[model samples]
Target: MQARKDKQVNDMVEKEKIYPLIVDESENIAYISDPETYEVIYLNQAMRETLDLALGEDYKGRYCYDLFQNRKTPCPFCTNDRITKERFYTWKHYNEKLGKYFKLRDKLVEIDGKDYRLEICVDITDSEVHNKDLERQLSAEETVVQCIHALSGNEDMDVAIHSLLEIIGGFYRAEHAFIYECNYSENTVSNTYEWHRKDLMSRKEKLQDIPMEYVAQWKEHFEEEEAVCFPKYCEEGEARLPEILQGLGVRRHMAAPIWEETSEKYGGEKKIAGFIGVDNPTKDIEQVSLLHSVAFFVSNDIYKRRMIYKLKDLSHVDALTGLGNRNSYLEKIEDLKAAHLKSLGVVFVDINGLKYANDHFGHPYGDEMIRSVAQGIRRYFPEYSYRIGGDEFIALYIDGTKEEFEERLDGLRDYAEDECICDFSMGVNFGRGNVNIEEQIGYSDSMMYVEKQVYYGSVLDGRRLQHKALARKLVRDIEAGRFEIYLQPKINLETGAMVGAEALMRREGEDGEILLPDKFISLYETEGVIQYLDCYAFEEVCKLLQEWIKSGGTPVPVSVNFSRLSLMGSRVVNRLAEIRERYEVPPELLVIEVTESVSQMEPRALKGLMEDFEKYKFVVSLDDYGYQYSNLAILINMNFVELKLDKSLVDDLKSNPKARIVVENSIDMCRRLNQVISTAEGIENEDQLNILKEFHCDVGQGYFFSEPLPREVFLEKFGGHHVF
Candidate 1:
């Protein structure tokens, strides 16, 4: 009995010694609680300190929820049902009451014949934070790789840029992502691209062409730190938000500068061309390194796109005049053809004295002349003018009216005459409703050539000399009766009867030789003296008609040719009327001949002239009708008694079937109109005459019957007979 009592005493001593050693001295939290009552039965030193209990303060019999969790009820995470005596139950938990993470081991135990719960916890706050950081780093690396792949694989810059922005915005949880290009020379910045969250509105439209001053602070930051990052966007005690950022609702932002490296041939400097940026990012605002990496790819793409655009521009632009070059002109022609335009106006312009200027004053002066002409054309037709050659330009206007085209042409002419040191020969054609562009351009070009010929002809045998000397010579020759008249008979094709005669002009040289009109007419026209010669010829014809009437000889109608320059005078028609009325010659006995090129005159003015001639009861004939730019509109609109096929059309009648067809159609068209007389000039043989007779032509005049004869020779040859 004494031995059993001694053993019991030793067991109690061992329990008391082991409990304090294992629980009281441990650094981890340890606690024992009654399972049924949910009360804490024991607390170790770590648990007492964690609960802020003073030394020796009693924790026994306290509710575990009230002590460990400060809860009024048992902890929902008690783990009582999960604990077993077989082994410790291990779990992890975050203790809100202590603001720490823990790994806990809990077990069921029996103490003094009562069941209790025991738990031990190890704090793991530092390790948990470290692990979370590692996860974020890996995710960031993956996102960056996606961005690089997107930029490298796409050939289209816009697509690549959009993909990159989406990737960055999605990874950073940003409300907006964008790029802004800087034009240092212009002192401007523009929002070139943007991506916004689904619920947010895009700010790109409103942010264009912003002054660089708005982002001066950001650029400063870029220069110093290679980026701009702000969690709250405050700078140097300035509490007020910048208006630009505030307008964008940007509470936090980050950006990295985009840079380009110049070629070593160009000094190899790095330039800040633009920036990539994000607004109001929800995460990773401090990851400026990612933005820098993206900026490198973005800069390369931007540089490549710009280089391509510049090369394309160079290909389509004239280097000296800044006008569309030949390539652009050809491309525009195709576009115009495909457009099926409602109306079109084309103007062909040629510099008249370019070759003269280049030969006399060097190529620089000629270049200046070309540039001046291009500038004038662009001023009127800004969008569609092209410099197609060294001294030639063309302009096209879609849906433009004839009147508008003529008005613009007049304005260009006045501008050239008043402002430029060079002269221009310009031709214009306007058509409505599905007109052929190539045909219109060809017609306008033909008209331009006609005007160019007139210009060259007016320059004293195509040379620049003292104008005073030529003027005086022309006046002396006119006053000396050196200008004379000749006649070419128009014959009826079937009977070979002379129906009429065309009066031609000749100049008598100083040595008594006959000079062709071409030798002096252009000079006379240039001196503005052709009107006097025209009046002279008309008066002489009136005299011959009056003499024939007094002598009782049969007289045929006589047609007199008038220079276009002479006809342009306001008093020219009146002068001819006065001479005809003074001589008492019947108006029907005299025919007035005007060349087809008169079609180029202003429509209103040409119509007025035709009406004035009709008012005088004069027979009007269209001369040289098939020469160039054969305008059917003029023939249909004007009241002409005769249409003369030009010498060129008749010359090729035997050799070219196309020419025969054209002539046949022309004669058929004329014969259909009011029985208009179709006269074929330059008939040289029986084959030509037979062709005209087969086509039922009305009049034939050429060297076939007679060369132009002097007045005395014509009267002597067919004095009494009207038929030859």
Candidate 2:
């Protein structure tokens, strides 16, 4: 919103410039007035003092003409007559009531979609200096000096750029002056530091991803170390000049290329950072040397600021996650001690089972989990979150009251757990003014640890704690998409043709090792975290199906195993339905594979859950049929399309008569019900394969034909072979 904003106020520069600068207040008086009402919205102390008015009082909404001149009505000699929505007017005027002459400049500035006039009135009537060239050069140098002073402070970079832009704009007498930065990574350019004459529109929002190749000629001139100027844009022929210069409505243009004295790789070559340009609508090119000098000062200031940022980043930013580092947290402690912060809040976040993840899934998986947690912190509380230690984070809440902060923290916790799969323990404390930030952080961390201990059953046993911790890390990995979807082709035993494949979940380990599901599934199953894992697999399968469809392929029925934990509620139905609709995958194309434990769960609830899937038209199969308690009632009630004989039965088919009897009975039952029976595992030899073929098995998955393959390999090898 527009009030009595300082002359250097610019939204573009102040928000993203990270490193800010501090500057002394200008001696000249300034104020902004609503043009429609001729009422003052802001009047600075300098203006009040010069007008013989009281300071620190409510002068806002006062009639500008009446307050300054004590007039019963409007002033007869108004500078606004020369200035319009697109015009800036600068002149010397004598006040009728005050009996004093002043040098003034006025431009229309829009704030919050409202029109106002920014009036900068300098008391130059009593000045003894009269040399125009000397004054102009001195003024430019003075503004540069003030900007340099600001750069010395540990303030924001936006403020520094704003101050520099203000000086350059006034020096060139331009309608607009802006900094165009090149994003080397994206190979694009954007308008960053921008200043428009009051009431002028900002073009920063409209300028995005401008290809550098579009302005090759302009850059070539800068490479020659010259401030490229094209005073006559329309007249410049397209044969030798860049057409992009004309594309922008640049009339009288001059820009100097900004450079940094550092390199991306240490001891390597220095590089060109970007460029600074100004549009001179008034065509005042006499101060060309002065303009270049100011641009040089800016170039060096930016370089220094970047260097400082680099040094600061090393100490302040976490190397693994890029969140605020421990050093940054400690610095904030001092800042908190110094300032009287009203309603300061702190949220301590600790990742569960990080060690377990690192040990079981490998450090890479653990690292990805930590990064996901950090990303969540940034999403919820940017500019306030810190990575204080391995798997430990802290967030400062300063903008809200204690209650508000607690509410937001609660919402964040729920979101992270339910949607992001980020299992975390959070402890928070906040309220009132003048709090000990360090103590609060410690207190919050302690509360988090206590809760964590409670989750571990308050036991001193290391193995139990370790296992529970892994469960927590598994949540993070699942949330972070750290699992790989490998497809094991299921072949038709009788036809000797490839059919559908089962989606297998695998995690990446050290040196690109593929960690299998059997490695940790049992532990997760025992801990009841298998439900989330199953959901993750389902979501990934849905995503893969959509991708295959996008690539112009008809996919087969992909089997996704379901846990008993997921069958207890409508949560899985809603989640799976949402993803199914999003991918536009028909329900019949996705096979729901149920573990034997699910068949043994609360029979009524299990039947209802299976019915819900059937209602959605999904093909349901009982997976690992002979492993656990075999309740034959589910098979009759659920209306299954397939049954998978347990691996134990198939592995002992040659020696164990009981296993063979169970397998034969299962296959015979499947035949009676018009169902498909698939025998998996222990299919390494032809004898075992032939045995399954004799039993009239429909499909088989194991190392006999092919192991599980990555998406790329699967697509290359069997994705072309569609069952439907």
**Candidate 2 regions with alpha-carbon error over 4 angstroms:** 1-247, 250-308, 316-526, 532-558, 563-590, 594-724
Model-by-model lDDT, in order? 0.82, 0.73
Q: Cα lDDT for residue 512, model 2?
A: 54
TM-score on alpha carbons, each prediction = 0.48, 0.46
What CA root-mean-square deviation does each model show from the true structure?
31.2, 22.4
lDDT of 2 by residue, 1-724 (tens): 3543542453333343211211132566777777778888766667777777754576767898888878877777776656766766888776766666678878886665656777777766455234555787787677667656756553788887876676678767787888888888789888888988786777777667789897676577777645767553445553243556555666577777776665555566656677787875464465555555666777887777778888978888898888889999888888878887777888898877777767765777678678877887787778688999998999888857666776778777766665443356788888676677777778898999888887667544445544444566677666655788898888888876777888888986545577898876776777566777887888888888888888898777889887777666565676687888988988877888887677666767776787677667778778888786687877767778888877777888888887777787788888888655554554666777888878777788788888889978988888788441
Residue pairs in clash, model 1? none
Instruction: Tell how far residue 693 is off in model 1, in angstroms.
Output: 99
Off by over 4 Å in 1: 1-25, 29-131, 232-242, 263-267, 319-323, 334-341, 349-385, 399-426, 446-724
Backbone clashes, each candidate: 0, 10
Writing each residue's lDDT as its tens digit, candidate 1 over 343-379 gives 9999999887666656754575467668777888999
